[model samples]
Target: MRDGELLAFAEEERFVREKTAVNRYPAHAVKFCLEYGGIDITEVTSIAFGWNAQKYAFVSGGSQMEQFYDSLSKIYSKDVKTLASEKEILLRFQPERIESTLFQALSEVGIRVSKKSPTIQYFSHHHCHAASAFFCSGFASSSILTIDGSGEETCLALWEGRGSQIQITERVELPNSLGWLYSCFTEYLGFRPYRDEGKVMALAAYGRPDTNLERVFDKVTGLVESFPFYRVDPNYIFYGRHSYGRRFTDKLVTELGAPREPCFEVDQVSADIAYQLQKRLEDAVLSFLRHTLAKRPKNNLCLAGGVALNCKLNRVLATEQKEGLFEGFFIQPLSSDAGTALGAALLENYRIGLGRHVPLKHLYWGPNFSNDEISGVLRKSGVKYNRVSSVATEAAQLLSEGSVVAWFQGRAEAGPRALGNRSILANPTSSRHAEAVNLKLKRREPWRPFGSSMLLDAADDILIRSEAAPFMIQSFLVKDSFRKQIPAVVHIDGSTRPQTVTRENELLHEILEKFRDLTGMPLVLNTSFNGLNEPLVNTPDEAIETYLGSDLDALIIGEFVIKRNGTSPSDLDS
Candidate 1:
């Protein structure tokens, strides 16, 4: 965004259909953003890549074969040894080879390159994370915190932002990372480390944090009193590794019991392990924040990184009681590596004096489909659809009647969340709807809870809130009276992650209003529009294919509504 206006923003995953685009260059995403802004590559002024590869250039480039063998030995099994070795080789040579590889990739994507290519710049990974948070926090000055798995040589950073400029105050180097700590636990719990940390958070709510587990966590992450940082005990978990294999050592397994197998039932031990890890993480972050804010006082706080995606921990930072600490908090909606792209662009814009410090309002920056495009796809697929005059009303009626609706409209969301754009909507008032959607439609785990899309005005009434949460990045306690009223959206702990819709989301707000008028409820059960293990639908065809394959009662795309042969408007009330 330039001058506080969103010209264009998108995720590479939306174009590639991959959950994460870590190794792939965002060629399609770049093209779409340029086209959306009505500009050409030559017209672009500067390009800032998210990672600073030069930081790793000092690593000794010994025999590539020996380094490869060492990488294989680090893995748990020989089945994936080759893949791990290849990845290690790539990582080892990436610093020197990245520039030429990037140039070639860009050239293949039709971007012009030469000795000087639009003043290409590189941003340190954590710098982009900090920029994405502080620049868009809407505060004239804020205390910025970015924490993630090892980025270059750093894992965490603290900065102070004042009048469009940020000054780094502290940095915690690699091998002492909170993100890696959590990710290690995630792997031990039989979940994908980076992708399924939220599952661990949810599971933690179901168990009690054991004293022994807490003691182990405290020892693993030894927080320093003199310094605002913690040291990760490498004895328990691997500190430096590129593979997804087991990072937890035999000592960790002895301390926390055997690792949970994937798809196994969530036992008490696994839940307790998750609970202890979460508690320890919260303690570490709170301590760090207190120390940082004391040295450099700031009322507003901005957070960005993969760790910031932990809504449970975010809740503690936002609501925790601490003297002379932050009173206001803003977390980047896309607080993951995917968001580094946006952060890089914003940092470059600020450096070039083409950016304005403004708080971000919404995240509907991806590609949008027109009515014509929707019609063409429907026709090509030979599917029957009606061009409804009011898609909102039709969708609202369906929700009021207890039918699940795949609601696809406007631009796709840029983050891992669906928000209102690409979502599966169901009646939040039905107690059984959560199970029905999980089993019949989504085929997801029964323990996984659903989120909600609620009117902004109704948020306070339903949730215990101290701030506005436009993104579903924080969980709030649902009011006692409304727990049974919105059973499908409430978790076992009687809390909910809600996307509070306002005028900025005009269409979604209108649909919520219609739903409220019909059912006297102000929210709908909302979840990402995808089946189990599938990335969210990106294109119109993917949306249609998912809709037809699932047991969804109806599909709403743009102004069109497609329903199964026997499904009718009357089916909504039944």
Candidate 2:
């Protein structure tokens, strides 16, 4: 992120072949970034970590240990030895130990410098989240909100950014996290916390809140002045040594009924709970923003952290501008912990007087395989393919015929959303396309809705109050008339997550235009080109392997096109 331009960025999961590979040192990711930038470890100026571990340990260690000890007393009633052991575990979060572990891990991965060791700097976790949004937003000034499932004991932080500076106005800590609250509900509704939160969000669309269910949640999260935005009763949540374990309490279960078992069918009760929880979260965020803007008003808003990934919640925040609080909205696309890396870099760059912020134009910052490289892989694999004159035209022609095309071009996308480069594309005009891809190809739940990749010109025609949504991170209501035309991408709530493409995305934009020219529709159903429970395909080999194994209609890699069912690439011309 030198000079506000991203030199290289990638998630470790893409290279490790693990989904959401959390708590793992991103050695491969670091290696890729250094290699991509053509710099040795000695050439690096400084290393910035997204957490201020010393402050976290000093401010939160005692309180967290106390919370853990109390939770054990309530749950077990007589586990003195166990509680002591857990307290010891919590005490191990010392900054010196953390720093030593980091350096040791990096050295093991060949990340050692030949010269003087680079100066390592640590920034507050929430501030890093704020920086990621406010800096990349290209706004001169904005109100920033960062919320996540407890980053170094800080659950949420609010900031005001002006010029090259950002000031933290308020901060919330520990057992009162909106992210943890949402995750608790996500777990209770037969889903994995943090990982399956989007599933809960999707399921909410199918539910209507029951008054009793609403009351239950409201009671657990009563209004309080100590926490300005929201409140969570620690009694209803377990703040434990291992944050990844089950977080909901027995008290919550006693009130809300038993937790749903994993892989079990979602019942009406679960849906109703999801609905009430989603609404509660939205209400809290809206109230918090209203209070913030009314006191010290700002026209632009920037949001980051894991909760910002909720497109539905983002829509609520964006549309709230009608009430005259803010005029502009920008959400960091990689709004999770992954984004903190970028934020840390930007913060360091700013400190060194190199923070001439360049607004993010695109997220194609990872590895790219050339045509010759792709050709070599295909030849080695002995797969039949043709080097088409224009791969976009060929891919579009295949899509117009209702075929699902694995479109792999340019660099892999930086975040979870597939912005065309590594995508499984289908015609969005028919509902069958989505169903077929979900059930037969990707092998995921059938109810998960696909996103649409449309030309920038089509946004106004397709969505209400359309804005430039190139990142596919914001949801917009589908214009009633256009909903039926792209049913594959439209959610049950009549909203669609769209990546609006312009000339900057030349190849994907060209593909969309060609599809529109043939079918009278400007969008295509675009989903990540990965199999069930797999990270997105990062290389031509992974793309080819997935394409060969799945029920895809065609594979488009660089200039080469591979079709199934004995179909020839020449047929695409006809």
Candidate 3:
């Protein structure tokens, strides 16, 4: 963003169709951003790399072996032999090889530059996370917190943001990470760690937190006040290890019993463990925040990193504002590693003195298709399609008529949540609608609840409070009177994650308005536009393919509409 104006921003996974595109340079994303901004690569003033590869170089060079071994000793309480083996494995991280691979990727995309070509800068991973949150938070001065899986050497950091500058007040270096702890439980519950932590959070709502289990978690991974900041007990939580392999040691397994197998039924035992893990995480985070708030006395707090994606924890922080902890809070929409690209750019902008702190209004920063593009794809596929004058009203009508509609409009969204632009829409008024979507469309777990895209004006009427949740990042309690009215969106705990729609995306706002006019309800069931285990549709071709393969009744892309069977798009024009 230059002077508070967004040129372009997008995630690499959108174009590549990968889930998380980790370690992959975003060549396609960068090309699209430059084209969208009407600028060439040569026109760019500087490039800021998000991760400090040099830190890895030092680690791999064995310069920090003693420090690393000392931290591990404090956590593992292991003998010299065991620490030596761990150090040997750590030395295998070839930073030079990683750098070569990144440069080769850039070269393949024609982004070669000499050392004197431009002002290339490197940023630590957590610094970018902090800048991503605090800079876009629109707070003149605030306390910042970033917690995620290991980033270079640090896994957590606390900062003070004033104006366009931020100072790192404290940091919890790796070998101890709250994110790793949560991910350990995520793996134990038979879900993919890092990617499926949100699922764990959702499942936690169903189980009761066992005090004995909670005590066990505290003993293994509790936060300890370490003067400037808190640190996770490293003895139980393993960091600097690959996420694919075993996450917990024998000690954790002895305490928690056997780990759940993937695709197995989630019994009461697994659910209770998930609940206890989530509770301990929440308690530890709240303690750290309370300590920070007491010392800083800042009414505004900003959070980022992978851990910030935990909506349950975010709900506590946002709702507890009434308790005087904070008056304003903002979490980055893309709070994972995918957002580090934007964070790097934002940090460089701040350093160049061109930064203007402005609250981000939307996430529609990816590529969009024109009517001609949509029509071309439809015609090539030999599908019946027509250009409708009122796409919003037509889609709203289909949704109101108990038909699932695949909505593809404007540019794609950046993060995991699909905010109306690329979404599957249905009526939220019936439990059957959600069940059908889960069984026929998504083909996923029945226990998972769908989200909603709600009209901003009716948020207070339907939800417990009217919060600006444009990103669908936080869940709120559904009002008792409206829970039955929007059963598909209401979870077992009566909470719904909703994306509050305003005039920001005019088409989506109009659709919500028409839906409300038709059914007297202000929300539509919204979920990512993809089948089970698939990434969100990016191009019009992908959208059409998904629509044809799924049980969707109709698809609305741009101004063009396509329906299954013999129903022409013009049939809904009336």
Candidate 4:
């Protein structure tokens, strides 16, 4: 992020092949960034960390520690005793600890740095989230909101962004988090809490919310007519052994019935709870934004944090926005904690008078491969392939004939959605293609709908309220006229999360144009190119390995194409 321009950005999980890469330092990610920037660790000017450890410890006083110990005792079903000094030491946040940890991790990667090499800066977690969204949004002034499970002692924050500055307007502390509320229900519905919140959002569409569940949700998270947002009951989340273990209390179970086992199928009760939970979340967030807009009167809204990744909630916010309220909406593509790294960088850059005031154009900031490099890999693998003049035309022709193609091109996307680069491509008009890709190829739940990448010009014809949804972060209603045309990409509720491909994205745009010319559709079903729980393929070798392992019919890398043995000649015919 030198001079406010991104040189390279990537999540460590992509390189390590681990989901979240929990508790691991970003050694590989740092090495990649430094190598790509053509610099050594000594060349770096400053280091920024997202967490304000001292502030967190200061805000969380002795009472908080006592409550945590009590919760631990309940979790173990017995009394646990420890010295106050020991507890203080454990709770204390040390800058040296992080410095030493990074030093060791970087040393393992052959990068050497002295004990006090670079100036280290620490930024508040929610502040980082706010900066990531507000600064990248390019709006001169905007209302900003960051909501996540927990960031130090603060769980949520509201801010106002003006020029190169952002001011915190309000804060919601722990046990009052909308993120934790959603996560609790997410776990209760048999999904991994933070990891599977998206699954809950998808499942909510299948459930029918009833008055009983709505009432329970209202009781669990108190709703009022005015400010301070909704009050989430601490008794249901922060009490006893709940939050430390399963993250919910017996009272929550008593109200919502037993929690679903991990292996259990999605039942009516769980689905209904999810549906109501989603509705309540939307209502609460909308109310807060309305209050903010009324008080501040901002023209743009910038959202970050894990909850901002909820496309349904984002869609609702986009549609409900009125003329004088928020006319523009932007959500950080990497809205999770991983994005806090970006936020920290942006904040530090601004402080140094290198702030950017331009909107983010695209997310193709990860590693990329050249044609020569890809060809070398193909030769080493001994895969039969041809260097065609047009990869898009070839891939489009294959996709039009109900063939699934692995399209790996340019830099891999920085965020979760494939955004055409590292993607599994399928015919969007074929439900059978969607089924095969979901069940036989990806081995994901059949209920999850695949996303689509469409020509930007075609958005108005396909979507009800067509806006430029370049990232797959916002869902829009598929017009009734076009819903049947792209059934494979449309969800049960008739919405599609699409990445609008303009001419700037040359190859993907060309592919969509060619497909529309052939099949009269401007979009193709696009999903991340990886197996069930893996990160998107980062290198050419992993791409080929995944293609060979999956049921995809063709692999398109650079200008070369590899077709399976059984792919009929007719399928490739143009």
Candidate 5:
């Protein structure tokens, strides 16, 4: 979860196969908690709901449930089957509606439950998102900010986390959200709003801002001096489909192009829309940073939220922070809704129990498999695999010669990224290796650069001078002296999100050290093992599925290394 705060959590999406089961209270999510926690009903003393809708509605004067239905029906389609399946959704969904739909589902599941309010305590949605991210950052204290499309009523919030305690200093609520502004452009471009914002971010790198972000937002919200990032509205703007007061202006479409209907193929219209959006967002953030940093001005910052997932904006933050500004950074991996669950529980744990903040140390917070299980999988898969004497050295040798290896071991990571355990290992020497993997096998955008995993100490000399970045969050400038040494991980901007390997990541450390010896560089190009919209591989079969389905050259699990199609673990398919 965001900042490794989840001892347990689940997404409502996983339970229902719908594109996004939005606006619905997380009934199945809560049910997963009861099952995962493995206790009798009411045995648990605490529960943390991800969204505090009552507080949000009061703050923004908007309808949470109404917006939910509007967004969901639009994206997933108004199919009768989808509406029918709504009946089978868990009984934990409430605010009062759970009494009708959820009670029956609970009955079918063999819980003879009488209806009472579920014991869920609410935390501000973005607060939970930020808290989850910061707590998992391994930082005792930092300036924490959560920015996303409006949550409840809040779009942006500022806080300070010290030890196990956090205090919110400032918050910018709805109608002023940078998230919704980005999503609106996402719609105008005809890409799926929530799903394709990343595509918009990628598209931004290829163009310049032309469409006026400020002009669009000014029609309904207030004044937009700084353009797309923040507005000077007297109150927050709510941009749901049902919103009447305009946070989006008709003038924006006039200046740019006609607003796109939902689900149109992305053309030049979409690309230009994305371009304007990315540029304006950067302008808005730099403007907000000038304000926020004036008060806090700490070298280190902690950020969480769905918008925080934007790597390019993160790059700008890094450069500005490093110019004698903020000294360090940590962005939560689970920086979205699922992470809020972890943050809510952790917030309660800190608020009530110790009344102190907890420091983060590592990200290995998911399920781990046994060594026997690893062995069993290799034998069952019928691959020519062996528990090698030194898996790190063997794997390093292969990667040094340009082999693309899939590494799956230990616990699965909680969020979207593959830290090390569930990563695909590749050489840092060439972009062609990345291109082959992305275009031919994994089927991802060629434009999106992968990340680098390197030993902590080794990073000081090569990537940046004494740059002690542990997590792959903020970007580091690729030193001009060694640009060609590691071309695979470097972005077009000559930066890379470096995950510094430490003794804490002992297995990862060994691999990096071996690669250092073999290739004279301590860095490896690492990306998550999953392909496209699938989840990370959590079981042996999942690992096998990834190994066989893709163009990866090898599968290395624990000490066991297996090759595909008689291709040595050290060579590309060439």
Candidate 6:
């Protein structure tokens, strides 16, 4: 690891598919960092894991590490030999047991080194979540907040990020989660518990939840007897049953109508549930913030955790702050579990007082491919394309000509926001263009407005929050004058989540600059590279497949731009 280079990643994203993937370990991700940094394994000073078994899943029967192995042995029930060698079985299942496995996996990927490895340890999950936001926020001093389902022994934490250090202000422990409440709403809507919460948020704006949410929220808000906000019955795992969370879910089902079944299309009830979820979370965040700011003088807030990813809740927070609620918003783009990697690294750096803080100006820190690499893929895949000397200029011209373009530039964006690479670019001048995208490319809910990415200097000319929305966290008013000019990016409330691009994000800035020279406007309508039900395109192949399958006019993959050869929807022989 470099002086401040704390490489962090999640097991689930690395594996691509798995639940509670915490079991697998980020072997590939770890190898990527070491090889990419050109650092030797022995030279590496520290290795930090984003999870802590001791605090997270370590049961007290004397190291759940032991318990996990014992339980896992039952899975291999046929291994009756393992029953005779119980210690061997116990040794096999501990995460520590897999330490060597990680080293072996890394080697298979050509990342070989010494067996001793680097100094290793685990950071508290919330601490890392807090650091990921508060530190990157560029706030020398500010109140930091992290709210999620559960991390270690706590779910919500209040901290103060001052200089290169962080101090925990206060925290609310597990079972008391605003994040869990939001998830409950997801369940009530018949959406996937952890995965489809955002769908609910998008659906919320479509229907009116005429029910008195405030009165209903009183059902489980203040305190559950002795617990803070809500409590968990320790007898059940993850605040309640395994597949489902809290026992209160039964109460929730009894209160609300029967949950819609999955594969059953969205309806009014789903919309109402979405509406209530958004409404309740906003109220709770406001309450939490009021209490927080009342105790501190800082006007700025550093938001993270899964809850912070809710742009609707974030918009509500921004509204309050604009009315002098909080001074500024610096919500980390990777505010979910994926961010815990950054947090884990930063936490270690702070404890040892080993590195200088680097204020993040953009979120394009993931892997980047060169023109050669893209061309190599094009040649290998047998995809025909006109390779360009100036990719951005060519892509912009295509966009101005009303071509939906798959705009892949530099590295893949580090977070959910497609700041630069892995984005579909189009004109924001027409609402119908967005509709066309929905009817064809994205196939996403029409209510979910595509995000806006504008030249850093031109941000003030179009949207509110003129200067500090580099991370695309806060929502800003659509400068009444520019709303009509860029309706595709504006939400129904006239607020928009904008990616403020600057020279710091040189590739991204250059792309927008090129577009500006062609279109007179500095913004490009940007959306995630994926379609309706797919994950963001992580590899070149995924990007190419999306371009070839969708209605996009052309795809600028690195310097190789592929112009679509197909009949336009308008050209169809009806």
lDDT of 1 by residue, 382-416 (tens): 88777777888889988888888999998888788
lDDT tens readout by residue for model 2, 49-155: 88765543545446443554465466443333445645664555556666666667678778875447677788888989999999899999998999988776678
lDDT of 6 by residue, 1-574 (tens): 3777534332334235233344455666666566667766778767666667443233567564455444544542323333344445344445565567767766776767675676666877788888888877777777788888867556788888778777887888544667767676676566666677777777777667565654455565533332243442322222222223332244455455455664234476566656766776776667767766776675688888988888878877777777886786777788878888888777787677775565676666556677777777877877667755676677677777777888777756676677767788788888887886776588866677788888878887886656657767666778999998888888777877788887877766877888888878888888877766665676777788777788777777776767777322222110
Predictions in order: lDDT:
0.79, 0.82, 0.79, 0.82, 0.66, 0.68
- Tell me how many clashing residue pairs each candidate has: 1, 0, 0, 0, 15, 0
lDDT of 2 at 178: 87
Q: Which stretches of candidate 4 lie over 4 Å from their true place?
A: 56-93, 243-245, 262-266, 322-324, 566-574
- Provide the TM-score for each candidate, comma-separated: 0.90, 0.92, 0.92, 0.92, 0.78, 0.83
TM-score preference between candidates 1 and 5, better one: 1
Q: Check candidate 2 and list the clashing pairs.
A: none
After superposition of all CA atoms, the RMSD between model 5 and the true structure is 6.7
Candidate 1's error at 552, in angstroms?
Answer: 0.8
lDDT of 3 by residue, 512-553 (tens): 999999999889999999877777899999999888888888
- Candidate 5 ranges beyond 4 A from true positions: 1-43, 55-94, 97-118, 133-142, 161-165, 209-229, 232-253, 258-275, 295-300, 324-328, 382-384, 464-466, 567-574
lDDT of 4 by residue, 1-574 (tens): 7778888889899999998787788999999999998988887888888888554343444444355545554543421223343255445445667777887888999999976587778898999999999988878888888999888667878898988889998887766788989988888877888889998898888789699887788788866775566788755764534533356777788887778765334566777788888988888887777776687655678999999999999989887774445777889998988889999999999888887864788988899999999999999998787777788888888999898999999988888789989999999886888987976468887777889999999999999888888889999999999888789999989999999999768999999999999999989999999987898999999999988888788898887788886433333321
Tell me how candidate 6 scores on lDDT.
0.68
